[model samples]
Target chain A: MSDVRAEAIELRDAVVLYGAHPALTGASVRIGRGEIVLVEGANGSGKSTLLRACAGLKPLVRGEGRVLGFDLRHERAEVRRRTALLAHRDGLWADLTALENVQVWARLAGAAPDEAAAALGRMGIAGPLASRRVGSMSAGQKRRCALACVVVRRAEVWLLDEPHSALDAQGRDDLDALLVAARAAGATVVVASHDTERVAAFADRRIVLSGGRVA
Target chain B: MTEPLATARTIAAKDLAVERRSRVVANQVLPFAGLVMVMFAFALDDDAIASRVAGGLVWLAALLALLVTVQRSFAVDAADGALEAIRAAGADMRGVFLGKVAALAVQLLVLEAVLVAAAIVLYRVSVRDPLLLVAVLVAATAGLAAVGCIYGGVVAGAGGRETLLPLLLMPVAAPVLIGATRATESAFASGGATPAEGWPWVGLLAAFAAVFLVAGAMSFAALVEE
Candidate 1:
């Protein structure tokens, strides 16, 4: 009823179809700016779809939605610019070094070189480790490097899917702090994770999805 | 320049830089083109190959190389989710398409230059209209890059893309192959067809480039979207 302008993400009866099958059906959600929201759902429950939609990676085939005051479909590109989605794939190039990967993201987001370096530092990637090719790094290290990319972006919205899957204990702790920091910095955070308890302490709200609708 | 253009430049730089590091185009495609030229020389008499068949050989070599290079453009990005990351960055989709076209066009043009020189040397082809040959090369390369970019995006996430791409690409590329070959033929033809005949084929090549460049830019977002 109130102004949807200020909301970070607003959706009503949003539908995302992959071929004939709807991955997200009649989904409705409202997340305010700077709030940490967690999406809990089973494997086929459309957790990734919801996050992807929020980041404007998945377009709404039906219904209506707005991400950061931009239409979820028509203004999808703009929405994606403001939001960052870290999916199951770490999205790191194998031939590129950790620093190069982070730098690429920083450049895309128009962030400064120092900021990218600092983001890597925050993720505990430095010295020789910073220059190591992503393929050569351990899975946890690659995850950390990718998290560093998210950190450097400093986007308005953060959409993370299965954020804790390949993370070490320290990496998980760092991720938790990053979520808290992003929220405190006035960025909306939506995390889709099966390990809900790990992020529960910092989450401002919890949403559970079943059959593509809020349960 | 606008942000999209800047982003496009960055993407192009990254792609070209990667190719430089990998040497895929240099070591693999370039040599492949040379070998194809040599094999053509072996099969056809040099006297016949020089003026008459040389154009066809050059186009065929470039076409094969285009298939490999264009496929790599998407393959590298697809593996790392770099394409997804780019889209998420909110860089203009058109800019992404243009950036790739520019990078691939440059690489292709470089390959074209070398192959043309090789055709001239190995086959002893003389240029009646050097300018026309250059024009055909430029226009054809643009068409190839634009069309390749579109299909590259289309097959990014699809399975069996390595095999799927040539099947999807070769048919559509027929116009380019015919147009470029004919244009090249008319360019150096002493009496094969009037030089005027070559201009129309060049026009066709230009039309192909323009049509596909616009199509790729308009449809790029839909093609790459998950």
Candidate 2:
């Protein structure tokens, strides 16, 4: 154990499985505050499994991990509160406008309006589009709405899976800026991306998953 | 307590907003109740029979209102991705359930009043005691929403919800409907069976509400995450 003083996420020989097959086997990683970590692997290679475990979405089938000092097995809710998980599902109300989506999440995450709006606006997602129904928005724009959800939340850790999949060049640039800012503000951000070009640009460190363990 | 209440309020407000946007309660429920009332009028063609049974008719309308509304309330959450969002947001499912129950309770109350009023007008029925009627409405609506919220959460993730929802719900809600209608009829007949005589059934309804509310909260986490 290399005792890092400000470790945000620490997974120790953690194993997670879906039914019979193990997704993560003896996987161990430590992420420190203010670090931008990238998790990369092929499909079915446990990238998402690791991210889901770290975010407290899926329980570890074996071993131990701690998020924000809350044991993954015991203090699940505590870990969930301090971390935000954004998956392929935008998790926004399609009937709700972008601002309403952010506002709903902000309240759920116990964030203030001014802070949330500033976070969304900083990413250049603002104005009338904020109030337009997400169902009415384009794919890239909906992705931006999901991004705004993460920014508005006051979590110290973010587990994002393929956040840049549908974004355009400007959208990617904006996301990169947001990730950098999130890291700069002492939030441990773990992004799972198959896109090497984008990961190379913003990732502070990269962990590659082969088989079911970190390669 | 404050956070849980705030979370509950937020959940309630979000559901209300969606309902408002789509005019689900106002548009879908009112017309559905009206249709049921018209059907009940034709189903019981005897004016004397209809007048004598107006309370049960209205209570039946309320149950159908619950059937129509609770499923859609949860379906809306599932459709709008609100359920997944709430889970991802770390909300207490109990609070979320209570919030949904609260919203549904209010909507059910409004719909129940509509049913009661529409039944009175359409069937030319008279009320012996209005306040007692409202009390029955409150107790019955609470029970309905509580049970319906759980079934709603259950069916929210299942396939063929249209077929599964009623199949799962009717058996569970049958007791509530029987108890509510019996309580309402006894009260309306000016019989000695006061709301107190019906207290046991009311207590059953309240206890049932408590059980479902807790179960809804605990099970909600698993359901939404699924």
Candidate 3:
């Protein structure tokens, strides 16, 4: 068992259910602060659920879990406040421009307004592209916009699901660089992705899940 | 921690911005409401009867428009999981509820104005008490928007939300429809009623609005979260 004080994420026998069916059976994981961990598994292997559980987005049916010293069961709002979860869906308003979308998220996260522009620029979405509506943008552009929103928040824990699926080669490289910078900044990164080879170089560790338990 | 009121303001501004860009309310809901009033005029086929029932028709049009506005408001969030993202980002859900109610109320008020104008032009109804009419419009629109948002959040993310929203909203909204229509009839001085008679109904509308607004604010987080 990892020392609770040193860990950024710790889950013990966490079980999550969807109605009567179990999505996460008895998963347990421990990662120290500022570690970049890649979560791998098959289609129904509960990889996404593990990341969500760490982010406090999924309730633990039967286990003890904590992220950044916040209890997963009771202090979910605090966990959410300190973490950012990028789900499969980009979670952006299609009608809003990329800049407007990032600005709104930045304001919600209480970040400085200039951070919105800087984040977008960091994601390679500057100039006219920033003003373009998300509905009109290509899939890769939209993904980059979504990444900008995530970047602007500057959360301590980043739970990214399929973070590389829609990005082009350049966008993927940008994302890799962003991850490296995040680690250097002392943020914990837990990414659930199928591209193991791409993430293998920088990921400090790999945890595979099968039937909802860590394998 | 972000102040809840500030969060509410930001969300309200964002929602309004989305509406301004999408034009769904202007292009779709407003025309649908105008068309409903025209259809009512055609169905009545007599100026005397249409004028007699103009207040009821106006409120009815507002009710239908409320349904469309509520559905469209939630649909935008549901389309991209924006609400989930907002919640997961630790936004105060009560603020979200209030912001949505404010935006929906604004949209419904605009729809009511057009419907009232349509009633005057098509049904030849004259407003006997403009103050009473305005009071009824404000209170009724607030009540309608509150009720619509509560039910809208409940049914959001469900399959068939488009159809489920009306099914769940109409029955709950019956009180708003009845209260607004009766109060508006008095405002129009239809059926020999006076503006004095409408004050009580306005009180009822205000009470209904207050109750739902508080309830929605308290329950929105639970309703939206998984």
Task: Please give the RMSD to the true structure for each candidate, in Å.
Answer: 2.9, 2.8, 2.0
* Per-residue lDDT of A1 in model 2: 23
Residue A25 of model 1, lDDT score: 90
Distance from true position, residue A148, model 3, in Å?
Answer: 0.9
For model 2, how does the per-residue alpha-carbon lDDT over A72-163 read when each residue is reduced to its tens digit? 88777777777888887777787778888888887877777676567668656788877788889888888888888888776788999899
Predicted model with the maximum lDDT: 3
lDDT of 3: 0.90
Interface RMSD of each: 2.4, 2.4, 1.0
Pairs of colliding residues, candidate 3? none
Error of 2 at A144 (Å): 1.2
lDDT of each candidate versus the true structure: 0.86, 0.79, 0.90
Docking class of 1: medium
Candidate 3, which segments miss by more than 4 Å at Cα?
Answer: A1-6
Candidate 3 per-residue lDDT, tens place, A25-100, comes to 9989998899999999999899887877777778998999988888899999888988898998899999999999
The candidate that achieves the highest TM-score relative to the unseen native structure: 3
Task: Give the CA lDDT, 0 to 100, for residue B101 in model 2.
Answer: 87
Candidate 2: which docking quality band?
medium
